[model samples]
Target: MSESYRVVEPQTGVRIGFGDVWQRRELLGMLFQRQIAARYRQMLLGVVWLALEPMAQLAMLTIVFGFLLRVDTGGYPYPLFAFSAMTGWWLFSKTLMSVAGSLQDNIGLISKVYFPRLILPLAATMKELFDGGVMVVILVGLSMLYGYLPTAKIVVLVPLFAYAALIGLGVGLWIATVMVRFRDVRPMMGLVLQAGMYATPIVYPATLVPERFAYAYQFNPMYWVVELSRWALMDKPVDIAPPFFWSLGFVCVTVYGGLMVFAKTEKIVVDVQ
Candidate 1:
């Protein structure tokens, strides 16, 4: 008599693995929809809030930097200069802030689910993208209002925006993973964002950053992304090579580290809940 051996098959449903995430794309879409709906639900201004927030910031910066500090905007109106930078910075900061708390806030689902934890942070990013689209409309209006219509260089914005989003996603993933283990990360992130607004070349042009510190300032990826937005929209000359490479390297390191950390700690995520 021949002995028979049993073969075990790996589980096939959605799980933490990368291949599983690709298979569960529908679930990611659903999560994105849920985030958008929740963000706008029961709000009087709804989507208008997106435009208003940036507009208010632009107005304030125009007054403080343009009128008070007497900053030069490369001859473009201060509102245009400030709005362009705010467009990219707002997307990065808002996406990072929302995603950092996603894991803890969605613990109820994480404990019960077999989906990729990365999905939570990624879905939060989509909400920022939706708001960013609204900001683009406002930008177009402001461009025409200031008589600074974009030239063919505006076509560069597509790739620049993609770079901006990837930077946010990579950093958001890293922060979200860390926040799960260190609850203090969230508040520290708020402080970082506040400091970043001042450190970045948002309210003023890169020319005003002083020649000696320009190299050091390039270490901040948002500085490049913000400059890219202004260059794309305003046709200004920008040093894209250094920051672009730095952003690419930073994204790779942060995303890989985030995924590994998340995979290792996810096993205990439910226990903490």
Candidate 2:
């Protein structure tokens, strides 16, 4: 006689295991679509805000850093230099903030849902990725207007964008997991983001860093993000070899650790007061 084995699904709220997310993929897609629609549904400007936000922020940086601080950018125009760097920085920053606040933002749903908790963070990230694409279109137009013709170097942005996503999501997942237990994390992340803007070379050129502090600076993952972004779009110099490996190692650790921690805490998140 022949026998057939039937597999049983694992209980939800136990752990955010591999099988759990895969089974709930449909719900994730539904949530993603809902977020996109909700973002532009009531607003008068709608999607245009995505394009305007980056340009406005860039203009502010141009006035403050380029003209006020007089941060040198070799020969490339300040607008172009800042735009290229901001592209990567905004992606990381926006995604991190969205994902970090995912849990708190979806309290009503979280209290009632039985799905893998990871979907909230993933959906929040998708929203930012869509917003980032809008900014990229503006970037191309600005590049042409500045008389900086696009070159084959622009191809490198693909990997840099993906690298930024990984780092952003990786860090976000960690924060989201921790925030579920300690509500204080929400306020602390604001301070971190505020400080992170100055810590990175978004408005200024990486060349501005002194030789004495160069070694310590490389430890910052975003340092490579801005460097590679400029190298790709603005024809600026960057030491790609080291940053490539450093970012990859950092991504692996952050993502893996974040997932493991989330899996452990997933069952208890909704119960937290």
Candidate 3:
């Protein structure tokens, strides 16, 4: 009798394949919940911190841009202008900060587990989404308080938010991957984000960028994100064509490029540790 022969496939050492990530979906949910709870864990004010930060920033921006800087957000009230931009900016900044150090901070889990590395940054994104919901409620309340009624244009906020999330995720993925290799990226990211707050039209109107520099200025993706948010909430007229194309282009390049870099680096992540 002939002996039976069997062949076994070799393991690739790629710990985070697509199926592995899907299998761990429940872990993602738990991480999301933990992030929310951890954020307000020891704070006396608890979840109120979410509303307070944006509200305070809105007030400050309104005063500085409306009164001191004399920047016009079309005919919309400055508070509304600032608040709308703040809505998007808050989400972007929060997501960036949360994901930047996620890989490094969770090195223990990464080494111990065989789940997708992308989950770390993704969990950070989900936490931002939860925080963003609180901001939306605050924005609605402020609109009512200021007597600005919502119109059909409010529907635009959906897509505008989706675009913002893509920007945040793309940037976060890039930064998170880099921070894993170079810890210095985190502090430098903080400085860049701070400068970005002013560079972006968060507190000011996009028109303030002189016509001569307009083309060069659009390189900052946040410019379009902020502009779109204002247009959605304030019913302000915007040349959506140019900025929309710019944002779409940015999303494509960053997400693709970031993923490539992340995929390559993730394999060697354990070696670096």
- The reply for model 1, stretches above 4 Å from the true place, is 1-16, 241-243
In the range 1-273, model 1's lDDT, one tens digit per residue, is 699796656434333478867778898899988877877886867878767777787778888999999898878788888888888888878887877777888998998877777777778877777777788778867887888787887777666666666677777767776777788888789898889888998887777788999888888888887887777777768765665687678777876776676666666677765
* Candidate 1: worst-modelled 10 consecutive residues by lDDT: 7-16
Reference-based TM-score, model 1: 0.88
Where model 2 places Cα greater than 4 Å from the true spot, the runs are 1-16, 241-244
Which tens-of-lDDT digit does each residue in 227-272 have in candidate 2? 8877777777776556557767978899888877777666667778
Per-model clash counts, in order, read 0, 0, 0
Which stretch of 10 consecutive residues in model 2 shows the poorest summed lDDT? Answer: 7-16
Question: What's each prediction's TM-score?
Answer: 0.88, 0.90, 0.88
In the predicted model 3, the residue pairs found to clash are none
Please report, in order, the local distance difference test score of every candidate based on alpha carbons. Answer: 0.77, 0.80, 0.77
Alpha-carbon deviation at 237 in model 1, angstroms: 0.9
The most accurate candidate by TM-score is: 2
RMSD of each: 4.3, 3.1, 4.0
